[model samples]
Target: MNFFQNLALKYSHTMMQKALNNNLKVELLKEPQAKIAKEKSYMLYAHIPFCHTFCPYCSFHKYYYDENLAKNYFESLREELKIIKNKGFDFNAMYVGGGTTLIDEEELLKTLELCKKLFNIKEISCESDPNHIDPKKLSMFKGLIDRLSCGIQSFDDETLKKVARYHKFGSSEVLQEKISKALGILPIFSIDLIFNLPTQSKEQLLNDLRIAKKLSPQQITTYPLMKSNLTKDNIAKSLGVSFKDNEFEFYQIICEFFKDYTQNNAWSFSLEKNKLNDEYVSSHHEYLGVGSGAFSFLDGELLINAFNLNTYTTLIKEKQNANIAKAHFSQKERLKYVFLTEIFSGSIELTHFNHTLKCDLEKELFIELKALKICGAIYKEGDILRASKFGKYLFMVLMKDFYTGMDLVRAVFRDDARLKNKDFIDIMREDVDPLNAQNMEFKA
Candidate 1:
């Protein structure tokens, strides 16, 4: 990498980290949050936050799967959806993500049915794990889900075992068979792969790609190992290896390997047109997310729901809403976000940006654009600015840092949720203290 490029990326990391820390100093929301304009169309992202086993590297909010609690959670979610609809908001497209969204197949279908019935939904996307990818189960999702992205982070058996995926998802050979069976399940079938794991090697990465090529899904998303402090510490103890990134080399290999595949974004490769990747933020400028651990972005405000199951469920049931915290971003900050996302997607239309931001980009972002250009990160294509190869790599790093910051922010909110839980109305009774062992009558 050029010194200039490295310097620009470093600067961006620092700036973004600062912006994230500032923006995420959240103000706890009072009950019955204020309404906003319905001028924009939004993609709905519904989070299913229950996983059978937790992976050390993931930063998303998740809890262990509990069937009864999940049932109640879905019931609350449906009510929350109705409340949003009553607020005069509607969703165009929907994306279901999660601690394995397919854990309770029946409830999932029921929720999707309600969403479609309530809104004018054009398309729906869902995420699942390899263990849940059965033909019978997938058959039920065909009409409902346009895209199904399964998390298959690696195809190396030892790597899988290191991450504890081998026991849960399956061995690499079994995963290959499972993934092969998933082909043609939906309009777009995407499998996720993570590059540059703690102790992962170049040969292992190439091998994973080779297997991915053979499985031949409609879309494949290769992500760098994005680790937050929570995951970073856990990854060390769990994998017994440092949480490091070989981003530049691994990313180049991925981009080179997927030459025939269309670059849907910097990291997502697609075999077909009009298919969506898992990154909802890239496609939707503002999105409304429901369920525990969900985030909703409107204008410059970010609303976050409680991450705890009890808090989320109780809030939704009582208040008909689960929004627990909020943070505001300034216009400049919003523009910076747009710049990163648009450039990451390969190009930025100058006219669209100027009209939306109501500012002359050349005047406002002179230094940023100039720096990126001088660093060989972006090039001009008429009125549009496009990312050079190195720019894509920079974007990957930038986004990783951005999300890591979010995870750290979530850590704060999660703690806040625990504190705020005490003040909630009609609190669910518990025999044992979750935070303290004082209520544990079984304690010796």
Candidate 2:
């Protein structure tokens, strides 16, 4: 990226970050009316926030595993699901993300069975950690899950140790074997990777790509390391590595590796376009988000569930929804959001933009489009706008910044959700203290 391009990205990110802060001035909610036509096809997003262990780099809502607490959480999850069904709302697809979607086999299966019985869901996608992939578990998830996205941040043992995953999950070889066991069992199996770790080299990045290609899963999703305050600090101090954003260079390597794979989302590369990766936004425009810490974006309104587990369970039992805050974006902002989602998915057809959004895409998003063009991020073919090679990196930047902003949002509510530990600091301690090995010590 040149000086001008760098400046453009920084400025755009700054403005968007500012806008996010201003727009997410969430208000308290007693009842959230998240209703849609029964006939309309939409996606269902369920957030399961329990895991065996917590990664400091992960900013999404999550907690350590506890059986009794998990049982209660899943009960509330079922209540919320039933409430959505009672409201005459329907969905055609479901996506479950988490601390670890498969943390508790029984609870997860129960939830999936209920979801299948309640709605006309055609496919279900769930996230997993390498440790959870076993033959017994794979056999159980046969008909319950259509797609399983396993987090393989890096296949290098040294990198794995740096992130403290070596002890928690396993070495690269163990993880590879565990992940490989899922092939042919599920319809769509995806490898989730993160590039541009602060201390990762170009060769290290290439090695990750090569191994991922060798496995040849149905899909692969790669993200640039998002430098958020809490996560960056944890990774840097825990690993003794400097934090740098070498996104463009890292993305270039990924682009070269996945040149033939279809871009389902800016970060997602897949064998075919028919299968939906973990990103629910690309598959469905509007979705019903259920569970604590899940977000629902329907029409122009954003409904955020309570980040605190206790509060979420209470709210769901009483109101059948866990929403604690809400934000409604302006029409222009909504247009920009649609444009960003479309372009980030690798292409945007003007016809769908004009007809569905009922606005002049060129005029409404003129400023964003202009900056993207100047940065050589996007170009117009006939009526479609496709992201350029460099433009895809810009997409990564936008997504990283957007998610970093979300971390800040999580911080706002983190104070209330530290039920396991004394506070967030203590929670960070669990991840860092166990495997705070020096770079040389961690080197395999």
**Which candidate number would show the highest lDDT if scored against the true structure?**
1
Task: Specify the poorest-scoring 10-residue window by lDDT in model 1.
Answer: 435-444
Steric clashes per prediction: 0, 0
The regions of model 2 sitting more than 4 angstroms off are 30-39, 417-444
lDDT of each: 0.80, 0.78
Using all chains and alpha carbons, the TM-scores for the candidates as numbered come to 0.91, 0.90
The digit string of per-residue lDDT tens for model 2 on 1-444 reads 788878878887877776665555555464655555546767899999987876767887888888999999999999999988887888889999998999888889999999999999989999999877787887898988999999989999988887788999999898888878878888889999988787788898899999998998999989777766668788786555745656677887788789898878878888777567577876666788888888888888777887788788887868656776667778988877667766778888999878876788888888878888988989999989998877877777776777776675566555554523353334334433222111101000
- Candidate 2 clash figure, as a count: 0
For model 1, residues 179-246, the per-residue Cα lDDT tens digits are 88878868888889998887788898999999998888988899888866567777877666744557
Quick one: RMSD of model 2? Answer: 7.0
Global fold similarity of model 2 (TM-score): 0.90
Instruction: Give the lDDT of residue 361 in candidate 1.
Output: 80
The lDDT, on a scale of 0 to 1, for candidate 1 is 0.80
